[model samples]
Target: MIELDNVSKTYGSTRALDSIDLTILPLRTTVLLGPSGCGKSTLIRLIIGLIKPDEGSVYVEGELLTPNNIFALRKRMGYVIQDGALFPHLTARENVSLIAKHIGWNRDRIQNRIVELCGLTKFPVDALNRYPAQISGGQRQRVSLMRALMLDPDILLLDEPLGALDPLIRFELQTDLKEIFKTLGKTVLMVTHDKGEAGFFEDTIVLLRDGCIIQQGTLSDLVKKPADPFVTRFINAQRSPLESIQNKADSKVF
Candidate 1:
C-alpha cells in the first residue's frame, strides 16, 4: 500500500537514508530491523510525511505524498511512537480521543471507539480517566495505540512502540499486538531493533545498515542465506544467552 522509489534523505553531512526503494504490501506486517542510526526511524518519518525526502518519491496507494496532500493522507494512517508519546496532562481517554475530536467525531462515537479500543488493547476501562503519569508503561502504549487507531486508519506505523516496557510486559503486548494486527488486517510497518521481535512478527523483515537496505525477506531467508556477513552478525548479535550457550555446546558436540 506504500511505496518508496529511490528515496534518500540527508542532514548536512550525514545521510539518514540512502536511495531507499521499498514497497509495503497491503494488509501485511513489515518490520524494519536495523541497529541504531541505520535509518529505520527516518524511513518511518518519511512514510508518515513528517519529513520530506531529498531525492525520489513516496507514494501511498499510488498517490504521491507531497506537502500539500500530506495532512489529508496522514488521516488515512495511524502512527504510534515510543512510550506512546502521550500528552502528559491529558487523561488516557482524552489522549485517545484527541484526533477524533479534532476531526469532528461526536461524543458518542468517540466514547464507543474508546471502549472498543480498550477491549482490543486489553486496557482497563477504569483507567481511561487517568493521566499518563498515573498509568504503567504498557498502558501508556496501549493508550497511544488507541489514539492512533481512533480514526480507523487503513495503515498503521509503529516506531518502537514496545521499546520502553519491561520484558514481561513487552512480551504480553507483543502477543496482543500480533492478534490485533491479524484481526484488523491493516497494513502494518513496525520499527524495531530486536531480532526476536522482528522474527516474532515475521511476515517480512527488512534489514538496514548505514541508511541502506541490505536485505529484505523472511527470518529463515536471512538466517539460512544472508546477503552479507553483517546480516548474519546482526541476527546472531541479538541471540539470547541461553541460545548462545546452546549454540556453543552443539558446535563442540558436532
Candidate 2:
C-alpha cells in the first residue's frame, strides 16, 4: 500500500501535482486517468521514489518513504515504463534477470525466477534468447513485465504499458494483464489517458487534470455523478465509435 499526503511538485511555472492526498488500496488496482501533463506520470514517479515531492510526504505500508528508506521500499514495488524500455543489447532472458544478477542471485535461483516469470507473463520459452528488436511490441512489453516481476514484488507500477501496441495486440494484452493482476492480487497502480482502458480494468479510477485530482470513483460513478464539470467533459472526450455516432445523431447533424 502507498499513500501520498498533501503532496505537491512543480517544474518552473508548471505545477506537476498540487496537494495530492491518496491512499492506494492493498491488493487492488488503481488507475490514474487523465490527459497528458495532468500529473498522472508524476504521481507514479512520486510513489516509486524516482522523484521527491517538493512538499509533504509519501508513505509505503504505513512507513514514511524517505531517502533513507526509499531504495528498500522501492524494491518491494515493480515498475514498467512506456515502450517497455528494454535494453537493445540484452536478450529477453538477460533483461528480465538483470536485477537478479546484479543483486547476486545464484544462477539456479535466477533461472528459476525467470522461468516462473515467463510462464506468468505467457511469454514463450523459445523467445528467451531473442533481443528486444527480435520480438513484437507486445512481446517486448511482456518481457518488460517479466523483468518487473522477477523479484516477486508486492506492488506493480505501470505507466501506459500497452499504449504503443496496435489495437488488437493492445486488447489481447489488456485481457492478459487483467487476468494476471487478478491472479497475483498485488497492489497495482497504472496510468492511462484512455477512458476505455481505465474502464476495462474495472478498478478504482482517479481522474486528474491540471496537476490536480478532478474526481476519484468507479466508471459508473463518474458517468452518473461527476464531481466537477471538467470530469464530465473529460469522460465525454474519449468516445467509442458507437458513442460518436450517437452523439452526432443526438445533434441531428451529419
Candidate 3:
C-alpha cells in the first residue's frame, strides 16, 4: 500500500537516503532493521511526509504524498516515536481521546473509544486517570501506542517503540505488541536497531546501510543467506553461544 520510487534525501554533504526504492505491503508488519546512522528513521520521516524527497516520490495507497495531500493521508496513519511522546500535563485517557475530541467527537463516543483502546492495549484502567509522570516507562509507552491507535488508522509506524524500556519490560512489551498486531491485523512498519526484535516481530525485514537497502527478506532468508559478510556477521553476533548448548541438550534428549 506504500511505495517509495527512486527516492533520495540529502543533508549538506551527506546523503541520508540514496535512490531508495521499496514497497511495503498492507496487512503485515515490515521492519526497517539496521544500526544507528543507517537512515532508518529518515525513511520513516519520508513515509510520514514530514520532509520532501530530494528526488522521485512517495506514494501512499495510490496518491502521491505531496504537501497538498499530506494532511488527509496522515489522518489514515498512526505513528509512535522512541519515547511515548505523551503530554506530560495530560492524563492517559486525555492523551488518547485528544484527537477524537479535536475532530469534534462527542463525550460519549470519545469516552467509548478511550475505553476500547485501553482494553485493546491492556493498559490498566486506573493508569488512564493518572498523568504521564505518575506511570512507569512501560506504561507511558502503552499510552503512546493507545494515542496513536486512537484514530483507528489503517497503517501504523513505530520507531523504536520499546527502545528505552528496561530489558525485562522491553521483552514483555515485545510479546504484547506482537499479540496485539496479530489480533488487530493492522499494517505496521516498525523501525528498530534490535535484530532479535525485528526477527521476532516482522513478516519481512529490510536491512539498510549508508542510506541504501542492502537486503530484505524473512528471518531464515537473512540468517541462511545474508547479502554480504557485514550482514552475515551482524546476524551471527545476535545468536548467543547458548544456542549450541540448547542444541546439544535437545540432541541428547531426542
TM-score of 3: 0.93
RMSD (CA, Å), each prediction? 2.3, 1.7, 3.9
Candidate 3's C-alpha lDDT?
Answer: 0.91
User: Where does candidate 2 have its weakest 10-residue lDDT segment?
Assistant: 245-254
> Which candidate has the top score in lDDT?
1
Model 2 agreement with the true structure over 1-254: per-residue lDDT tens digits: 79999999999999999999998899999999999999999999998999999999999988998889988887799999889999999999999999889989999999888888888889999999999999999999999999999888999999999999999999999999999999999999999999999998957999999989888999999999999998899999876899888988989964
Give candidate 1's TM-score: 0.96
Give the lDDT ranking, best first.
1, 2, 3
Check candidate 1 and list the clashing pairs. none
Off by over 4 Å in 1: 244-254
**Model 1, poorest ten-residue lDDT window?**
235-244
